[model samples]
Target: DQVMIISESDVKSLLTLQDAIHLTEKAYSELNAAQSMIFPAVREEIKEYQGIFGIKSSYLIAKKYIGLKAGGFWLGNAAKGKMNHQSTMMLFDAESGEPLCALSANYLTAVRTGAAGAVAAKSLARKDSKIIGIIGAGTQARTQLEGLLATFPVEQVLIYGKTEGKEELLAKEIIEKGYSAAICPSPQELAGQSDIIVTTTPSYAPVLHTSWVKDGAHINAIGSDTRGKRELVIDRKPDKMVCDLWVQSSIMGEFQHGITREELYAEIGEIVNNNKKGRENEGEITLFDSTGLSVQDLEVASFVYEAFKSKFV
Candidate 1:
């Protein structure tokens, strides 16, 4: 098995935020058509290490490939001059079950997660929505904004971060990029001012309240991907809610223990394939629970493999 090694820098150069968004949509569309299968993720917390670790895997029938992405997030890594999130991807031939390639998956994770939120915003949010509120200042925050900016004609932006300096820097970066942006005092202020909100904080409890949100607001709940973690406080069920996959979202996504099957509007795949409705009314508040999918990683890896083969092989 000739394992083609694709490095981190290669991934960064090959997959732009726009490329991520487009390919992720294709993955979801194929999944909706019953052409893909995503296995359960194995995630765990290690108190001694002060980090989280997991393995995500998927199979794509249309592409004739299978793969797994394994990595972890270390809270102490920043002090070591490293990133918090790291991942590695391995691809296999679906028929022969032979290893085909290996890839760096951190950028894949960020972009796919960001694209997942952006896809939700495009499908569910108001078509003319302009203002966006960001609730995290981490690396994923930038990609989430980039994905949204690519999809919508944004006019203004609001952001809330724990550290003032970091939040200000993010605001400055956006402003320097020629966007109208600011750092809000709190999640409440950001929620109130934004037409669409993207929450990427790793808070265990709810960080934003529905009371602060306005009518017709759309929310991409991206932070809480595990049970007992949440970024939005949904005292009652949201008017409309969607997820990448109902099975995973109900168990480990932002919805976690809350939200019943009756409350879920549809999976993102269903909406993308037009098999179900997205947002039915302009006045309805919509929420998307993005539990990053394994198929997304596999999809991107396969896409890059082709590109790499054509260029380097």
Candidate 2:
């Protein structure tokens, strides 16, 4: 049997934010339906490297596949003209335990990650949400915008970044993408104007304060994947909050740093499957504490692999 190796270019060509969002939603629904399983994620801090190494593995029962993606952040690679993220996914046949395909997973990781935010926003955010506020004007900031556009008819986007020079750069990219976009001077301004807010920065201290977030706004806390990293400060409790995984979110996510299990309403999967209610009232603050998930990577990888096989064979 010939092993199929998928490149980043091939994956990017085959995958779109819309497809990723749709597939990821299905993945969450399957997870909530007990048709999928994600093993506990492993994240280790590489002190000398000043980054993180992680492993996410999962089993998709209905899809009859098992897979794992191993990679991590190398913070300085971008300056050296390499991707900061190095990830590869290996998919195996569930019954035979045979390797089926190997794929470059960095782009897969990004789109799937963005789709989780879209899933949360669609499941929990108010239906009338029109403005998207982005914190941390990086690749994630753009990806989040792409994902949201697929889910919501977003009218405008406001970007807030910690870095000085990158502000105009991200805003330009957003506008060039044919969206009404501009740079906001502060996170406070962005949050105040936005009906949906997404934070995508690696900051130790709180970049978003509860006071800045307007009532009835939805926030996706994306950056605080590891312990001690936080983007949003919970000075005032949100009305409803959910995470991808309760165990990981409680210990390694932003919840562990400032909030507790008692504060979170439910997992996003639970909300997606209608196991629990999402956004009972429009006038309440909603939050999704996303630490990212192995199932997400597995779902996208599996979808891409199937497509590759169909096209090639």
Candidate 3:
């Protein structure tokens, strides 16, 4: 087997945020159609490997994953198991099971998650939104900011984190990149000031409350990936509730804890594909409950893999 090795740098140079976004939108459409048929049939098989260390918890996750794009079948026993994660995205050929190329999952994951957030912002956020609030000062946070700036002409950004040092560092970096940046004293203050709020922390308790949010604001709840992790209190339902994956959100993340399944307005894919409406009126609160998805990982990985092949080989 000619296992083509792809380094992080190769992946970085291969795929751009713009390319990831376009591919992800296509991936979401495929997922929406396949979810009812594909997800259900394969869910049990997928879940059988749940908590298998690298497969579910640590190895793979994206807000809007496209299974065939970045993920692949893992065939092995627990005693001597080998995980096969594929961006074997063979859209380039039909006869050859031969992978066109390999992609680094780490970089792809970041791009897809960021692109998903941007998609939500485009659909759910107010047209004139200029200020953005971000919680957490990690890799995901940076990508969220990048994706937002790419999609929207954000003028100012407020960053907050559990640690002052990291928050200040991130603020400085953002400022140097030419965005007006500041570190907020609290999440409440950030919520009050920002037109679009994105929370990226892995916190169980609510970091933001309904009362803190202003009218006509868009909230992207990005951190709640697991069952006990949530950042927002469901005190009041938003005017529209969008999620990247309905089943995952309903069972595991932000929507898992507080909001009912019926309250969810639409999936981000539906909004992006124009199958449903988003941000109907002014003074409406819109929320994007992101649980992360497998297809996003697949889609981004596929994009990177293809790009790597085109440029390097």
TM-score to native of every candidate shown: 0.96, 0.95, 0.81
> Between 2 and 3, whose TM-score is larger?
2
Query: If the candidates were sorted by their lDDT against the true structure, best first, what order would they fall in?
Result: 1, 2, 3
TM-score between candidate 1 and the true structure: 0.96
Candidate 1 lDDT: 0.86
Per-model lDDT: 0.86, 0.86, 0.72
**Model 3: per-residue lDDT, tens digit, 224-243?**
76666679896777889889
Off by over 4 Å in 3: 35-102
- The lDDT, on a scale of 0 to 1, for candidate 3 is 0.72
* Per-residue lDDT of candidate 1, residues 1-313 (tens digit): 4689998888887877777788889999999998999887999987797788889899999789999999877778867878788889999999999999999888878988888888888889998889999998887898899888888889888989886577888999999889999888888888988889999877777888877788899999888777667787785456888888888888778767668888888999888999988888888888998988899898888988888888888
Model 1 spans > 4 angstroms off: none
Clashes counted in candidate 2 amount to 0
Name the weakest run of 10 consecutive residues (lDDT summed) in model 3: 52-61
- Model 2 stretches with alpha carbons more than 4 Å out: none
Q: How much does candidate 2 score in TM-score?
A: 0.95
Least accurate 10 contiguous residues by lDDT in model 2 = 137-146
lDDT of 2 by residue, 33-98 (tens): 889998878889888877789888999997889999998777777678777778999999999999
